[model samples]
Target: MDKGKNKWAVLVGCNYPNTKYTLHGCINDVQAMRDLLVKKFGFDPKNINLLTDKPGSFILPTGANIMKALNRIVDQAQSGDVLYFHYSGHGTLIDKPFLPFSKEEAIVPIDFNLITNVDFRHLVNKLPKGVTFTVLSDSCHSGGLIDKEKEQIGPSNNHLHGDSSISCSKPKAIPYESVLTHLSSLSNINTTDIGTHLLEVFGADASLRFRLPHVELEFYKALKQDEGILLSGCQADETSADVISEKGEAFGAFSNAVQQVFKENSGPLTNAEVVSIARKILANQQFEQHPCLYCSDENAAATFLPQSATAASSST
Candidate 1:
């Protein structure tokens, strides 16, 4: 961190407890990241915002709340500031008829409302020059979460398939059909249009990206911006795993791999370096998911977190 600048972070984890979508590792991921941001990266505890679905958590990771927090951070950020957002949860794809890809990626909040890639693009466009927002999304289908960004480490045909024999592991993905079924059940709307269901339930708070006309969505996708850096857990077509160890310890496989890389390296790791090391870690563990880095070539070579002298020395 530059002495003249400040660092802020928003760490979110959604373990949809008592529900069919429940997972055991997301909350743990958030806690570990919070510790890393404070002790290893020199972030003030007061500057980090935490949102989770764990019982008694004052702030829940609802879609509205998540967007609010992100907007607040972008609104307040100044030139040379360092910012980060880490998300550990289920990720899903939504149909986007106008786009060539045919779908858009989004992260699922605790209430099933989604925050889409277009939303992220809008956020990035608002960022001041010299300010960077680094995102680490440990979720399935997370590769392109920061829409239109350049790919540094992308999917390859040689990627290995996951080992099915690995016990106590679950993919952190909720299928589009399943999402529609759940939302229909909740809203009593029997249509297949996701936007309609979301509109019925969340109304004005629903993601505008979903409700926008196809022409507008196309226009938004065509606009380019470069202040966002994304380190996604896996390729858009792959699924990230949530694993439970023999001793009952649960964690996101990708998140654990990232932490392992940080522990094994002393000095600051570049955005590309961290994703590269994490990819190897996941491969050695027999996980099929391939971590990806998306940003400008310049950002790919930038430090994971701009660190103060004390923080850099302590890590060494």
Candidate 2:
């Protein structure tokens, strides 16, 4: 932790109530994380922006609303600032039409609109040097949420439970049928291949297309030279569980494991250790999902959270 650094966080949870894809644990996951950040991590309540689908909440976790909140966080960020983005929701992949078998990962909002990995890369590129944006995504196909960041701990390097096929090692989009069903009716489009239909309408370059509302072509094309750390819930091709714990409380499996690990471990843990521990915790609980850590090797060895040394020490 850097003493002089400012800490900010934007947490989003979308349960998508009344919809067919409604999740049972997303809102609970965010609430738990908010409590951990405030109590254990020394984050200012005022500096944290929470977006959820809960009634009477200040903001809904729609794609446009999420982008607005994220932009505000990025705009106020300066050098030495520690920024956090935690999202517990549905995640999916969009297939690239031009690139054979290429897929782009995306996080689904309450309104069925998606915030794709290209958009995340665009956001990461805007961070000032020395500013760290640590994102924890508890969603399916979230292993590569940060676009081009290196994978420090994943299936390739992890042999947990003798399972080497747990990770996809690449971006895996949700099936087109799932997307089409969630999107509900795609107007007059009768084809079952939604990916092809999307490419035909939105072009091969998803980041450059304005076919969807609240999406800006040039805005998503912005790229920076920096990278961030991502703690994903599962591998690119696996589905994260939103299970009811033994205590009868619903929570995302990865989110629960992370909070539990930090709560139980009083000593400092590296990003690699954190991911490994979380993976084992999930495996022991009979979960098929494998938590992953994505970042540069140097960042992987850095402390788990970007707090000041004193603050980090105090928490432990």
**Which candidate ranks first by TM-score, i.e. highest?**
1
Instruction: Score every model by TM-score.
Output: 0.94, 0.82
Write down the TM-score for model 2.
0.82
**Candidate 2 off by > 4 Å:** 1-4, 156-174, 181-225, 309-316
lDDT of 2 by residue, 82-104 (tens): 88899998888776544668877
In order, what is each prediction's RMSD in angstroms? 2.3, 5.5
Clashes of each: 3, 7
Question: Candidate 1, which segments miss by more than 4 Å at Cα?
Answer: 1-4, 99-101, 159-167, 222-225
lDDT of 1 by residue, 66-134 (tens): 999999999999998888999999999999755555887999998999889988887888888889999
Which candidate should be chosen as best, given lDDT against the real structure? 1
What global local distance difference test value does model 2 have? Answer: 0.73
